[model samples]
Each structure stands twice: as structure tokens, then as C-alpha cells.
Target: MIEADDNENVERLRRIEAVTDAALSRLDTEDLLDELLDRVRDLMRVDTAAIMLLDPHSQHLVATAAKGLEEEIRRNLRIPVGSGFAGRVARTGQPVVIENVGENDVVSPVLRDTGIRSLLGVPMLAGPDLVGVLHVGTLQPRHFTPDDVQLLQLVADRAGLASQARLTMIDRTAALALQRSLLPTRLPEVPGVDLAARYVPGHEAGIGGDWYDVFTLPSGWLGMVVGDVSGHGLQAAVVMGRLRSALRAYALECDNPADALTRLDRKIQHFETGNLATVLYAMISPDREWIRVSLAGHLPPVTASPGCPAELMSLPVDPPLGIGAVQVRHSTVVAFPPDAVLVGYTDGLVERRGELIDIGLDRLRAATQPDDAETVCAVIMTALAPERPADDIALVGIRRQTPAG
Candidate 1:
């Protein structure tokens, strides 16, 4: 037999779980948060209920959703961790109860201004991490019981899991969409050049910043790029897009790959400080007889010709972009005869954990026989990539076609 309080807690738990049930999973994150807050206020019989999510980067709690006290959200209230009642709960990862809330008990005066006389707050935890803070308040003086604290903690737990999942999903979906938009939909049709590229995102946190591009310059030269930014998720993807655009714009003004990369390095070092990346930029001659290339801490491309084995091209490698040191960039010319194939790629294609990278490189070298661009791209991906890769892979294959074959 359950006590009256225990019965009420069970009822409250049931109601709270209803909002986050699978049937309601279709609601957008914001809508779900709003609905959760509504249920919290009604179930707890509080005058105001609100949620403050932690911005780990800032180490501050930001007002995300509110009920009965809309000013908290409207004003974008922020509370430093450990500074006040809500902050204390977040910092300690424990429930905080203020029997009679005072002006100084909170960082923001909005609680006092709204005449919230009592507050019951709990830390929203996703595993050991404090994802945010959840609290409810009332204008009337009331003693919040342990039962109340337990029930609210349960609410925080549910909300914490949902919020983390929804936010991660949003970031992953946005990053993938942005990357696809930046990559070429169809390789440009150059009379003497055959091009095909492949990009596979890792199944990690969000998405990795791996990109490849091919375009024709005003001088009728072919511009080829394969680069990888150093981090995962949407932020890295955004940085990759900026670098791609800046390189293309610089390519228009500069005469050679080294000159364009030098300008790009200056821009990145000045503007995108702390962001590091490896970039390989090349321009095939209009006659398709040779390719001029520059590398920034990037792997050299592999070249293979008719009845010949593939080998990695050796060239002077410079420091990666945003190194913040004085450096020199150099371009090397490689002989590219008709029917020869060249492959440019990011490191992810030939790097496997617990295995020497030289072995992967040798395997890739063995697989790249003189073949059509599409076939080469497909073969390399199959030969080098794992069933579940740990990093993003970007590859581009270019072949100069021969009239006979």
C-alpha cells in the first residue's frame, strides 16, 4: 500500500514520462522543451517553471524555456555556475531548495521581481555531465518537501537526456547538409580531363570536415583540391567551407598553386587562428601534359600510367595552414601524360588506428592501377576504407584520356 505522497509522486512521474514518450518524439526540440516545461509547472503546482541549459563553452546557465515567468527567456537570463541558487545546483549536480527565496540567493533578480517566494531546483544530468538546470518556483510561501525534490529531479533527468539527444541530432543533420551543399554535384566537363570524387563522413560525434573540389581556371587550367580540417562537427564543416571559398577566390588572382596557398595561409593565420588543416591544391596544364601542385602538411598525390604501377609523388611539404609561424610554400611540377591518372586525397583514406600508416599507403598504391577516373575512385574507397571508419575520407581521381583508349 502506497502513502498519499508516494501515490502523488507516482502519478506525477507517469505524467512527466508521457511528454517524452516515443509517440511525442515527432515534436521539434524547442516544442518538446516547451511542452516539458508546461507539464512540469502543472504537475508540480508551481506558479513558474523554467529551464536553464549550460553552455559548456561559456560555463554559464542560459535561460532556454520558461512558463509563468517569460521574462527569464525574453531577457536571455544567464547565471554563472556556482554563483546563485540555480548555479549552485548545476555546479554541485545536486538538488537545491530555498525555503524562502531571498534577493541575494539568485544571480538574477527576475525571481524576486516575479514575486517567486520559494524555489526548488535540480541539476539536469546526462550521465555524469550537468547538461543544464531545472527549477520551479511559487509566489506563495510554501515548504518544498523531499518528495518534491525527488520528483523534480526525475523531471530533470528525463529532460536532460531528451535535450542532449535532440541537440546532437540537430547539429549532425545540419553539418551533413552543409557539407553536401558545398561539394560538387557534377564534376565539370573538361574536354581532355576525366574527374570523379568521393566523400564519406565518419560515424563519430557529428561530421568531419573533409572536402574536395574541381574547377576550371580563367587560363583554362584545371584546379583540384582535397583538404581536411582538424576537428569534427558543424564548426569544422563551417571552417572548411570558408577555406574552400577563400582558396577559389585567391586562385583567380594568383598564378600558381603556391602563391594561392600563401595568401590563404596568411588569411587563416590572421582570421581563423587555432584552426589547423592540411590542403593540397593543384592546377593541371591546359594541354593536360603536366600538373603544378602545392601541399600544406598534406599527403602527396599518387600517379599511375598505362601498364605502370602507382607511386606517391614526392614534393616539398610546408606547414599546415594556421601554423602561426613564418614559412615558405613551394609548387612542384609533375609529368601527366595522356592516359595517366592522378589521385588526391585527405589522410583519413590511408590512416588506421593501431596499424602503421605506411601499410595503408602501400595498399592504396597497390590498388591504383591505370584505370578510368570513376573506376579508380570506387576502387580506392573499397580498398582503403573500413566497414565503419573512424574519420572522414575525401578522395578525387583525375585521368587524362587518350584518343585510342
Candidate 2:
């Protein structure tokens, strides 16, 4: 009989571990917590189970996931720290067991209505930090054994780690979506030019402020831009979006790339005081014969003619935006022969840790030979970007189409 009981205990542990693994695999916090609560309720043979997470702003434990409870109670429950059963567990970082809920004054009236007679609450802790609380309840008054408390604590520990992981993933996903939304969804078709642009956020970095834009100007010219903001993650992305909008507004008002960048510099100096960014702005003429380019502490554009290898075009460099209150920005016009491609990219394309920038530039120049804009962009990214890049990359390529025979 003792051997049979040991086997049963091992199987139960395996089931609990399986449920915990499943919960950790989910990226969505709501779905993960819901699954965790359901599994805990089933595994413990309890009438109901719920999970609560502390709201940083409210300083209260809010019901994040619940099972076998009324929808109103599940959605509207909020227990302040040190107040109710769940709150006490969260505040004290310890487990609480009540043999009879009717005798406990700390039980909320709303929770009492659920017909719960016995309850056990454990702190969901991530190391030394209190993440939230996990609770299990029974319909009839019953004493919880020490083994039951230990099993519930094990689940709570896993829940804490899983919750943190889910929140991190959700934040990363949201930031990435916001960053992509700010970029040009579709490149406008120019009369005699083929344009292709790509943005790749760093694998380990979540998201960064790398962006590219192509739009038709009021004078029938095409405006191209590639930029990198000063930092990574959500703040950098926000600044990138603001700068992109401001640059577009400036580009629409001026015919020259230098003048547009000049205005953009003032806009940044006045509005975004501490933030800084590198920008490469170019205005391609309507005939596609020439491109007027301006660089703001950004890499010079690369060009490749038919039957020739790619080479970087040396252009005048200016201070990056948000540097000085008054700045003198300059532009240089380069000949854009038919069947030639012009490439603009952020530093991430060519810069790697402990390596000279010249090496990246040489690699980029060598990769840009006599290809369509799409092919050139793909080839450069595939060649330069590691499986998990350390910085965000943005590439914009434009090719003057060859006239049909």
C-alpha cells in the first residue's frame, strides 16, 4: 500500500509539472494565468482558484485570472495591500489558511458570497519580490494539510516566473507593433524609380528606433530617409516616430534636402531637447537623373551602376539633430545614371562590436553590385545581420529603372 501511495504521489507531481510547463510556454498573460488557475483548481481538487497581480499604480492586488467564480466577482475584485486574504498574503509574502471563512473578518463580502467555507492563500513571489497572490477555496469547511500548502506554494512559485515572462513578452510585442506602425507601410511608386525598404529590430534588443521612409514630394520629387534614434526600446521608438513626422512635414515645405534638414534640426532642438538622432535625407529629382543628399551625422549613401561594383558616395556631414540650437547643414547632388541603385541605411547595417565601421562599409559596398532594389536590400541584410542582431537595422534602396528597348 505504501508503494502504491508513493507511485500516486509521483504521478501527481508529474501532472503538476506538466501544467506548470504549459503555463510558462504561453506568451499572453491573460491566457497563461487563466490556464494556471484552472489547472491548480483541478489538481488540488478545490472548488475554485484565482490569481491576483499587484497593480503598480494602485498599490492593490487585482484579480487577473480566476476559475469557478462569478464573472462580476472575477472582473471587479480589487484588494488593497494588507486588507483581505489575498492582500495579506501578498503584503506579508506568506501563506494564509482559514479553516472556516465565516469566522474570518478579513474575507470580502463579495468573496464570501461565492459560498467558500475554507480558503488557502499563498504569495506568488519572483525571488524576493512579491508578484501577487494565488488562492484556492473549498465549498465545505475543511482543514488544509501541510502537504496541500506545500503543493500550492510550488505552483505559486512557477506562476510568479510565468507571469513575469508573459508581461515582458506582451510589452515587447506592443513596442514592436508600435514601431512598425510608424514606418511607411507601402513605398510609393515613382515614375522612373524602383524603391524597396526594410526594417529589422534587434533580436535580443526587443525593438529600437530604426526607421525608413519614402514619399513623393509636392514638386513631383521623391524624398528618401533612413534614421536611427539615440537609444533602444519604447522611448527611442517614440522619438523616432516624432522625428519622422517632423522631417516629413519639413520635406514637404522645402525643395532642397539641406533646407529640409535645417528645419528638422531646429524642430528637434526646440522640441526634443535631450534626444538626438542620425538622419540621411535625399531628394530624387522627377527625371531620376540626380539626387540631392544631406547627412546628419549619418552614413553616406552607397551607389552601384550597371556592370560595376557598389561604392560609397562621399557627402558633407552635419551634426546629428538635437545637437546645437543653430546648425549649418549642407547638401550635395550626385548623378544618378539609369540602371544604378542608391542605398541608404542606419549604422546597424554596417557597424558591429569591436569592428571598424570601414569594414562594414566595405562589405556593404561589395554586396551592392548591379541588382534590383529588392534583391540588393535582401542580400545586404542576409549577409550582414546575425541570426540575432544586437542593434536595429533599416535599409532603403532605390534603383533608377532602365528604359525599355
Best candidate according to TM-score: 1
For candidate 1, lDDT tens digit of each residue in 1-405? 469889877886686566557755678768877887887787778999889999987999999998987898889999899998989998888888887988788777788678888999999988988899999999998899876787788778878888888777878999999999999999999978888999888875458788999999999999999999989988899999999999999999987999999999898889888899899999999889989999999999999998888999989988899887745789999899878899999888899889998998999999898789999999999999888878998999999988665
- Over 103-147, each residue of candidate 2 has an lDDT whose tens digit, in order, gives 464556657777788899999888788888898999988799877
lDDT (CA) per prediction? 0.88, 0.84
Residue pairs of candidate 1 with colliding backbone atoms: none
Which TM-score value belongs to model 2?
0.67
How well does model 2 score by local distance difference test?
0.84
Off by over 4 Å in 2: 1-49, 54-62, 67-153, 168-186, 200-202, 229-243, 256-277, 287-290, 305-310, 316-340, 370-372, 378-391, 401-405
Q: What is the lDDT of residue 228 in candidate 1?
A: 90
Q: After superposition, how far is residue 252 of candidate 1 from its true place, in Å?
A: 1.2
